[model samples]
Target: MEGRVLITGVAGFIGFHLARRLLADGWTVLGIDNLNDYYDPGLKKDRLAQLEGHPAFQFQKIDLADRSGMEALFAGPYFDVVIHLAAQAGVRYSLQAPHSYVDSNITGLLHILEGCRAQKTAHLLFASSSSVYGANSHLPYSVHDPVDHPVSLYAATKRAGELMAHSYAHLYGIPCTGLRFFTVYGPWGRPDMAYFSFTRKILAGEAIPVFNHGKMQRDFTYIDDIIEGVTRLIPKIPNAQAAWPQDPAASAAPFRIYNIGNHTPVALTDFIGTLESCLGEKAQIEWLPMQDGDVVATYADVAELQEAVAFAPDTSLQDGLQQFVDWYRRYYG
Candidate 1:
């Protein structure tokens, strides 16, 4: 189970946690990140700083869209597994910077696919998002659902990445797994995420914006749960099925998708209250109309994930937020 693995967004929230976990499990990891300032490069650097000294961990500064750089990288080493997590992440940012999504999410993914095709990589696990369930009114989004209507450019790019991976898997026989992560939040999380920003605003006695007039719900999967699901999936390579079931999640080719989510949707108001309790403070609410490119709720149907890996996210929001609050106090102080 332990082997040399290449993790593309080594400085990212999930990628950082995954790398640390793999390194601890005795895997030699080559982690790469461009360290972009999409949010705060300083936080990304601090994440990297923690992983720099590990004997089994090595890092390279490379942007995924850099085709020549990626070519040079893949030429040097034969990565048994490539965990592609680098992308232009942010649902709202895509509205203002649409081209960046194409550049990073679409083109960047193409480079990764090409490298994997050339290397004939044993397994390629790439990050997708729950945003792909856009315009689908299903209570618990399932991989079997057709993701044709993406409300945001970010969601479109994610769906495009999934299709691209499927094509590569079919043609090149490269085992590819797409992870559809839900509202992932925890310590060392993205600054753009609601929970992270909420913690900061509440601590500073500022009004936190309550999107959708505080009527939205999200399946806030904790970071540890996400890592555990991904770790279990890394070794479970998909085999090409002789009988095609016409399921979007699986194919006759070596491709599969799974929703790694908590499966428990929490109201935005309730989530904020939990955070307030964790921080020992009250939140000033700024109620606002529903933002464009935003969903009213996200609930994951993790039946396939549980059946495949015999595991699903089970972390409580209260405990997860408490851990994040403790980390925030120590890190910010």
Candidate 2:
């Protein structure tokens, strides 16, 4: 084994992909997930099926908020890298299920930090979201900008996780990397996402909801690109850059944040058009007002990520969506 890596949400869209990538890279991966029926348990199971074929991959059905379970997992062996990707991930869903976000995103993350503190793990990389930039009116979201304002509970909790990790990194010297992922989409993608749902509707000849009156834009990043960014980041561990009098936000502990996103922002209408092209069918559009807990646009400034990892998510929307459409048709059939 190159290194022992633990990935929470191993059955998740990104986590599953990350697990496969790590296994191929000769790393022993220990994955954990509650396998809750958030989107589709069958999808999670299918993803798990793929990883289970690899000898280097081991999985445990456990919740991150389960303190005893987390402690037990950490008490056994020290993981070289802990990729915390598990969270109740939905901006709109947050309105209805706020507690789940708190339980999984906040309390669950506490357990992860505690485990790392006990083990003093080499590096910790966790998922953050572009939603953290909440109503900032910033053209392209940057890591240097302050994320004090958050619109949704999901975003708030993600930002909270970053703060918690920063504290852990500062106190326990755990090298932490906070990844602010943009609108991620592609194969084995979350069914709840607009892209996936839209594809399904378009296939079924139903109307796809165009939110924000079809004026919204999203920096849709492909799954492979996100995995590439994350894979590159795993090895570039953080080092505390602060002195006592320095700003904690800047020099805070061994903490750093990166915007892993496609620099291109695609309009919702154009995105749907491309998906239609890929599926070779026209979509019935249901233009509606923007729902709460949703942003009008998200563009990522990945200069920092490029500088650190020499990479950024550049997969074009047309290419990414077509790949997704292909996967959706194959997977559903």
Candidate 3:
């Protein structure tokens, strides 16, 4: 192994793929997840099963909120990098379960920050979301845009994670990078995501609910592209700026935020059409009014990401959705 790394949320979709990739890249990966029943633990276990036999991978069932466990893990070995991807991850669910967001997103992130601060990790890259764009009417969301007005509690907490990370980077001089991921989807995806649920409903010959009356748009980034962006960013540590922007995204500290997204906005109807084409079945869409805490469109301005890593998510929707549909059929059939 070239270096030791810690990945939280290892059983989750992005984390699983990240762990596999890092192991393949000759990194010693220590992965941990609470494995809560947020979705289905079976899916989580199945994701873990893929990495259990890997010689460079180690697994532990530790919650990010667990202070002692996190401290002990950090004390064991100095991680060359730490990727924090665990959180309460739904915009709608926060309405019913707000406390879960606080516990996992806010409090859990505190523990991770403390661990990294103590361990003196070289680079601490954590997951943020494009939802942080909140009620901004901007067409293409940028890292330089003001994110003070978040609509959903989920968005609030993600922004809070960024703030907390920045504080740590400033106080402790840690190299921190916050990735604002857009609507990520691919094989072994989250069951709660619209694309995943839509696939299930379509497979069951039922009408899939089209929120915002099929008028919404999203920068749906593929999971492979998301992981590739992150992988390519591991070695590109941000230096403390001499003249920091007034924007919270960049400061004199080694804290930087990047929007890792497809940058192309697809209308909901067009997305459904692509999925139907891939599945060879027409989707029965029941259009409905826009849901609360949902935006009409999300387009990313990944200029900073491209400038830093020489990469941006560019996977075509047709190609990405076809891979997803193929996996969905094989996984569910």
Highest TM-score model number: 1
Better candidate by lDDT, 2 or 3: 3
Q: Pairs clashing in candidate 1?
A: none
- Range of the 10 consecutive residues with the lowest summed lDDT in candidate 2: 242-251
Mark the regions of model 2 whose C-alpha exceeds 4 Å error after superposition.
Answer: 242-249
Question: Could you give candidate 2's per-residue lDDT for residues 208-312 as a string of tens digits?
Answer: 888779989999999999999999999999887756435423555888889999999988888888888898999999889989988889999999899998998
- Per-residue lDDT of 1-333 in model 3, one digit per residue for the tens? 269999999999999999999999999999999999989999999999999999989999998878888888888978999999999999999999999999999999999999888888899999999999999998799998899999999999999999999989889999999999999999999999999999889988999999878988999999999999999888888889989767666799998999999999999999999988898888888989989999999999999999998998999999998999889888878
TM of each candidate vs. truth: 0.99, 0.97, 0.98
Q: In model 1, state the lDDT of residue 116.
A: 94
Looking at model 2, residue 102 earns an lDDT score of 94
In model 3, the runs with Cα more than 4 Å from the true position are: none
* Model 1 per-residue lDDT tens digits across residues 196-235: 9888888899999998899999999999999999999999
Residue 22, model 1, lDDT? 95
Which candidate should be chosen as best, given lDDT against the real structure?
Answer: 1
Lowest lDDT 10-mer window, candidate 3? 242-251
Give the C-alpha miss distance for residue 282 in model 3, angstroms.
1.1
